[model samples]
Target: MTSTKDEISLAGRREWLGLAILALPALLASLELTVTHLALPSIAADLRPSGSELLWIVDIYAFLLAGSLVTMGALGDRIGRRRLLLGGAALYGVASVLAAYSVSPAMLIGTRALMGLAGSTLMPSVVALVASMFKDTRQRGVAIGIVVASVSGGTAIGPLVGGWLLDNFWWGSVFLAGVPVMAALLVAGPRLLPEYRAPGSKRLDPVSALLSMAAILPVVYGLKQIAADGFAWRWTGAIAVGLVLGAVFLRRQRRLADPMVDLALFASRVFSASAIALALAIFVLWGVNYAIAQFLQLAHGLDPLTAGLWTAPSAAGTIAGSLLAPRLAHRFPPGGVIAAGLVLAVAGFAVLTQVGPLGLLVTGSIVISAGLAPTMALATNLMIGAAPAERAGGAAAISATAPQLGGALGIALLGSLITAVYRDQFGHDAELTREALGSAAGADAFTTGFQVSAGVSAVLLLVTAAGAARFLPR
Candidate 1:
């Protein structure tokens, strides 16, 4: 509807290349997260990281990624999306090599955070690229679908691939694996990806960018710390700072010449609700998935490879949901379908608490993922679908931002809560810590920590479900 928005159909070589380039970042981002999770135990042993430190290594990237995305999205609009993508690819490759060589947990986590900066440039560009490449509405839908599918599918596949790598190599090998993939993307990206910039947006806002990071980092860091030490003043201070900064950031954005988040979009109930739903869905799914991975390895005594195999049910369900969402969207509005998916996810988590018998836990995961996958896809579609064409980049950025935040929050808050509950049950026992984390901490401390992580995860899931029903449209 906007004049600056071009109209052309995406087809043939140009369209395919554009979409592939776009999907590459999503794949990389998802891959980075998935591989880290599978490698956590290995990293724990090699680095001898404390239970809290291990959570930080696993949780920090998402927070950085989420925190930086809004600013990066706006930058893409001011600069050129394709130029940003190429630079991001190069940065990702360098970070990958650095990550592979990390001698300590601190180094690896720091490298991962840097990787998040590169990744921040990758996602908004991808969505903006699709909009730039495809002029026709129908073609745009298809392009978005494939791009979305590739990223979502990569997440499902990450554990399987990570499992394979862990079987044969050190945990660092998983980080090393990014090199080839990123190298290929870097080389192909420049030639295949076309440049795009917002026609009218020539200036970028510095204040908003700083505020955005301030608003996000504390909350994310706070949540991560909570996993190791529950209900502490330190955690409370961090969260409060983040929340207050976030409020200030939002206020500044409204008056900015070139704001990262377009406050006006909330007027469209569809857009706002969809964004919230997307975040909530990720919060629930990934949070639980994190616990499930640990349980598979620790309780079931499965190797990373075996854990991946068991998780195939959840992955398959995600794929099934993606495949079915387009059709379901026609019968049920995108919002309604997303809301339904939340209900199903809630049921899945509830079932997890009860499934000690008849593989109840494992069986419940499939049902939960089945519901979540479609919801993820639909929420993504709605976030952009209702936006003004010229603001697609902003809309997509909002969509991505929520999930990044959700992922960090989910792991931090839920992981911590689970650890608290797990520890409470142990009641200051030496063997409990020794048996629980194995080598994560002092005897009594670590067991208490791990259970808190699991319990927090369950409680947050309930909150995520509740949020979906109340804030999202049915």
Candidate 2:
């Protein structure tokens, strides 16, 4: 009884259900990114990982995920998005189980890397599928908003989820949470989701794949090193090599008949501007999130669960802002709306500089998160929209890659600035300088770090706001 038109129509019960299924993988991927931060202490106590090993356990997932996104995205276009999604889901579920049961730190780190590889496939496929599924402009906007919101929401709630699990269960319980979610997605995704692949797509190039990994992994590793051990020559060297490899990757893309990434996509002003704005927006988001978590725990002496609960309002604000963005964009110029959101975030950061009270910090976090969410959502929509229909997977991959790199760079650079300022205040007092300058000086040092970091975050947001207004197309 179903006509061809009825089968392909965008608006339907099946499409909506499929969207919900797609959101699960995106949410789980983002949750895994930050969930480990809360469990590190418990992991350390149980596994007895050295400082360097602990850092590896945390960094490997993101490093591999960011590195593999483009290659996997392009591969999905050559193969099938649905196939890639299901395959990744299976791998992710298996990896989660292994990670949950791992007795050694090395075993855990290896499984986390496998999860990242699986995650790389899931992220791009979900976004590209959303882009392909929603043919209407308005409907697509809302779909993208929902997908983007899940990612941001997951990031916001990751610690809270981890904290609650740690409170009631063992550290391994954090890894097990994803097992059920992945299972549900794997079971339902095939039945509900449509298959998509770029017509006439060429085979993936091995050299470009390796080059892409080489370009991204070192940059992320260098940033992690800067965050953990401060700036070092080796880290700088690693970054330099990454930049050179990145240049090579770009040059290779330009010459290839069937490139892994279509270099010409960046020619669209909307794509380039939106991508940059999204990256900068994420920089502010991740950096401020890290700084605020520290403030809640150290400055206010709140327990992990309590601190996470306090930040929950900020996550709510983000979801509200994302849902509200499409209506605002309809009424105002998109560039202006995005700029206005950044300005609001700047104001939020300004409140943090005052270091008034817990209420003020919470108020600032809500405003900043809410304001930033709209820019991120709209910018992501613009990036995906600007690309050709066939290149949706590659475009989504680039868009996703920007935020991963931005978050790493933001946390490293901004967090280091806060650490340096906190240490400077201690004036070479070794006792006071231990454990992030808060163990000895108590709330005073935490307050200083909070104020300094807020100042930096505010200034960056102001600059980014101006850029968004100037560069993002109305």
Candidate 3:
């Protein structure tokens, strides 16, 4: 007969396998998915897809992912995370090939949307699997750190990987980046990863699934369009329709026995407050990164490769902060750590706005990232920790929604702010072509845009900080 300690050790090894399977795809998916943002000009020059088509190609993945995560995650509970993870991995690889060899922009964009569906299937399922696999809260906390690290820091790796491929090969090579990692995971996954099915899950609820998609797609699409096309009446109409649908969807979720997202979890003051802070942190996270990247490439004349290198400090800071989060949480409450992170992130943004030096921005970015980094792990853990084990997926579904909304809104709000500023400042400079305005509107317009975006990001950070302090438990 086996000793209790031996059984425990075997169980521990089995639990770790889930995180291993998760980390590779989570990292590659995030990195490859967004890495192409910088290569838009190159894509336009080669494939010549129209403006709207290009935006669709850029946004359709996020649109689909954000819309479908809750539904897919619920499905995973009914089926099994391990089985679906392997299936989703296969789908991701197939879609990557399609994206790499697309004959038309529409084909490429559609494939990307499918890839997003595959991603949503995989993301929450991985987290759910981790929770189920690791019976130990401490181990799961560390596992959560790994997940947050992949989500937060993956984009940092994105530029370097995408930049290198753009520098040497072709634009499509960015999609190819995920291929090798997927292949390795597929080979190792079956042997290493244990299969997981919820012990007492019911059949997936169709009504809840349909309402979720209906509610999220319109809002995300409208926000994205607003970012690219400005504040048009059509976009406003879509937003209004979406919000109404969302209200209806929420009512339905509250009444459901098995909701895709648990609406009731917001009752926890700590959970609600942390979610607020987490959402706002994401707003600054993407906004400043987007603004700063364009600024460095356009104003400083760095190649995509070198420009990516300059971002290393910020990435490192984010990863470091994520790693330190659990330890900090042990010493202080989740609220304190989150508020502290927001302060650092705000101070970092302040430094970036006033300072023009590249080295300084990098240093500030790193410092700021360190602060905001731990918030994700702590927030995610807190949300999941309080959830009924059966509703872990639902809690995650709710948690994930805020950040995706924040990201889309962040991009749109910041994009609108910068575009409005850029237009007001340079719209009358009759000689500057749209392309030239984007490319060579000189250092001042670019700096002004960067400063404005940074300032707004700072304000959001402060708001998140205050929200955390006022409401969250000490």
Candidate 4:
């Protein structure tokens, strides 16, 4: 039988070492997400990809990663978490090497897809392993904080790292950077991490897994299309079809004796609330952060390296907030702490609305990162903690999935909004500005759109803050 939280001992040196191993994959997954954006121009120039092919090269990784997460998590639970993690790490390293050496866009896209599939296995397994290793409430909180910090920190620093790499070496160097990290994880994981498979877990269901992928891929693809090309009937239809399939998938889960996803877990208010809060927090962070990155470059006329350097402080703030969350939770209620953080994020968004000066933009981003990191860390802990040990992998997948969907939606919807507003500012040259923000006659139109987006983000965060205060457990 699994030990109750009360019966579990505090984590020791071995567990701490294991956590460091697990964090490598977590950090790598996030780094891969953001790092590739910087390399896109280089890839385009070298591979001579058409616009459509280039989009696929940039997006296919996330599409496969998000679509496959739930299935990979369940697979980890049925197999051994350690076994799955190490296997995935090996695959990731091989895929990264393949991606680096690819001569054609098709080859690069295929390798990136492989990397995404391998990435799907890493996060849920890492979170499940961390939960298993650090069973004590307080210790678990800190461990989760560290894991969350790694992800957020990696995202914040991705541009800086990618810029430096692109400056010194070929674009392929970015993909190669992950190879060593995965190698380290593969070497140490078997020795440091414990093996865990859910005891008496049911056989894996192929149909459910298919349904999950079918439901997720279309929706995510549709969102990405909207973000890139603006709204279209085809994309809306894709989302509608995915929603229908998702409903069907849920119905099947309700009837199955050994369902892939445990519906009962969502019955807990804690699980449901944490999931919602985490999603909303990511929604604002990613949507606003995306705009801010563009603002630093297109509006302010800074080069990639300079812009990355300007954004570095936000990365530091994210790490600080993530690490500080557990310590703060000891003194205040978790719900209160979360609400407070959201309020602070709203303030940051408010600052962003002014849309003047580089220092102001940097300050706003730093404040926003500082505020949202705590909410992400604490909510992740609550979501994963609410699950039974055997279901931790699935729980972790769900936790991870929500943020992916949220970030995608934020980028799509907010990006569309920004483009629309910017186009509105230019009557005769709308097409020109819509095609390239930097090529616009002036930065004033883009600035206006950014300000509007920030205001909308602030209002959404304020509402989320109120909900967190009222609903989440103290």
Candidate 5:
């Protein structure tokens, strides 16, 4: 491991305080991810976007964020982590204002893309800083847990905050929420976060960066289009082109003396398994979360605030799981704890399949979120730990990318399934308006959609649990 005098000392009080400051940006990044879900209807009403445009509004952020993560992480190593982070935060604040004031669908989408680009910088920087700050393994575990908790917690709380704002103000308020938080981070971050860069890191490859975006953007866009409109030549062509470009990207990385992505990292069984598991876990969590949020507001006919309040349990459960994970790992093997967490998610998904009342839905969400949180946290810890200390930024970027990809796939796959089921079950009914389908026959359609999605999610979680048991280090 490459070392410097800056990283030689064991962390003390200042380091911990710095962790708290770093969390603001991390929380800001994650909060933006989920906070827009409840506000979609409001935006649609005001902006009058088409169906495809509506989907793009949400998916674009994840698409760009996933595409840029590795490159930004590598950029952090070459430049400086804190420097990129602070710059990104400044840009994020401006993007938020543009998003909030957007008058057209195209403008909103463009601003969200900017937000995603800015977010890409923040995600890896803070995590890498944490890895640098707390050198002790046990302390790093807790510190990482806190950071993970901040992310999951932001997702859980996003709906409530967004809902409250929507109830009191306009949908634009959701995007505006980030302005002050980013400002706070800007103020506090420079004082707290220590800058770290990889020694002897090579100059970033512009071709690799372009190729990464080219590969990811088309694949994600194609997958989303496939879900919205059944297999078409354009969608298939996009996927094929993406795959070819991805192959070329991989080949170029192998040829580089200092690649943007080190091919050798995947060779470690621990890193690969943990990364895959993290992705799968997030895939299920985000998919289910998307379905539930719609179910609460559209089907159950709850106002935004009530829906937010009901959903709060899931975030609470995630926080509980994060705090409990390290202690559980001390008693049980890490793999076992992760497997147990998946099993809990399985139970939660099963509960949703029953199509019970709000109480049952809430209970299932709590259980599922609680189960998934520790799995994500512990798996991330493993991925970060498996890497060389100097490469922590890239490793953390990969870990962050898994969830972004999963969440995008989730919104595309599960959201499409819901639309398909809703149209099949109630689309022909003249009584239901397109937007008012929720008020008309929403319950039957949304519940059917939720049941279908939940059943699939449960099976995936079970299989993933077995994989966790078999592949992860015991």
Candidate 6:
């Protein structure tokens, strides 16, 4: 039943070039995510933001981005993907410039929020466009791998790039760093990226858009709160309200003639399994990376730039794994490949439990990165591939949203666990060392927490590997 066109790759030199152009937004978005971590201290020093305002400055962008993705994805399907992408790129460029010049905490927060909304358009469009361009399965897998690598590469280099900028220039320069990238994307995007709009797609439903945002924003905000301040009734209540709203959103979708999100896509085991696997992979990766970054800076007493350099190997490992995944899939079944990678991740997490030496920590991280990269790439490929072409934008949005939610949950739950362990282990001196991890007791307690969290992560990955093998299609 398969057509010859499905088997043959239609992508030519131009398509390859277009793929590169599409990757820029994904790379920039991820870079923006981590770049601000280093810039926060500089921002605090210059802007003198209140504690609440600083949190908003840091959190608002991600909150808005996550909440907006599903609506934007559906919007791309109704409008043209390339059109949405180019428009978003222009907005992102303007917002970046505004962010750089902001004189007050409130101004910076508003600009960051705009950047987040602009960013929501990029990932789904990029993925859906790539899917449309690469008709052949193998080529599509390879192309998505490259895109995934770009994301990982951006996250890895963000702090290093931000550190170098901070060393030479003011804090605002970090925000400006994205301007040129967006400018280039704006200039090159229309020429290279092909337009894709689903035929007969209805007008976007404003009510559905509002419901999606209302459901997602509260949940994301709650998770971020849990990460920062541990569990409280206010945070848990927000999560519960979001869940109720989410159920209402789903019920509304089932009744709509043309749903914003196609409820049928989740019926496919391949789609659902791939999505869950992808989320789990990111959950562990982001959670552990959070702890590791602090470990390098607070425990080992390294500068941001130096610590970033040390983390480069892990990025290289991820790049290598992503590039190699499609080739491996050609030889073995995709599910098996994913399972094998997760097993390798288990070994990597095992190594982390014994991270007494700096080398061991770095090695474990690299191994973990290498192990998870394939899951990210191939699971994404499987998830997108499972969707009908008409629904590719929504599918890509779901793909984008899962990792964001997972990363948030991982940071909240795992970060909270680590803090709880540290406090418990610190015993009577916990209050004394609360502000900084300067004391020997504080350092030792953190290390213990790190080890315990790694051990827990290892078990979770092991179970996930089994699920991937059993549930994911061969």
Least accurate 10 contiguous residues by lDDT in model 6: 432-441
Candidate 3 residue spans exceeding 4 A from truth:
1-11, 224-231, 428-443
- Candidate 3 lDDT over 215-254, as tens digits, reads 8777766765665455799988888888898898889878
Please state the error at residue 383 of candidate 6 in Å.
1.6
What overall lDDT, based on C-alpha atoms, would model 5 receive against the true structure?
0.82
Clashes of 5: 0
**Reference-based lDDT, residue 262, model 3:** 67
| Superposed Cα deviation of residue 358, candidate 5 (Å) | 0.9
lDDT of 1: 0.72
| lDDT, model 4, position 110 | 99
All candidates: TM-score = 0.88, 0.90, 0.90, 0.91, 0.94, 0.90
| Cα-based lDDT for every prediction | 0.72, 0.79, 0.73, 0.80, 0.82, 0.82
Q: Write the per-residue lDDT of candidate 2 for residues 24-87, one digit (tens) a residue.
A: 9878865775566656656766888775676577667766877888889888888999999999
lDDT of 1 by residue, 293-376 (tens): 766666656688877777765767777777677777767656567667766766776667654443776677887787777666
lDDT-superior candidate, 1 or 5 = 5
Clashes by residue pair, model 3 = none
Instruction: State, as a TM-score between 0 and 1, how close model 3 is to the true structure.
Output: 0.90
lDDT of 3 at 343: 93
Residue-level lDDT tens digits of model 6 in 1-474: 767765465688999999999888878866886677556656766887764576577667766777788788889888899999999988998999999999999999999999989988888888888888998888989999999899888877887897788778888888988888888888998898889987788999999899988997788667656644556999999999999999999999999888887889999999999989998998898778767766766567666677667766788888899999999999999999999999999999999999979999989998999999989899988988899876776787788877766765565567656667776665534353343332233677778888998999999999989999998877
Candidate with the larger lDDT of 3 and 6: 6
Q: Assess the local accuracy of residue 284 in candidate 6 as a C-alpha lDDT between 0 and 100.
A: 92
Candidate that would win on TM-score: 5
TM-score of 4: 0.91
Ranking by lDDT: 5, 6, 4, 2, 3, 1
List runs of model 4 lying over 4 Å from the truth. Answer: 1-8, 48-55, 224-232, 422-444
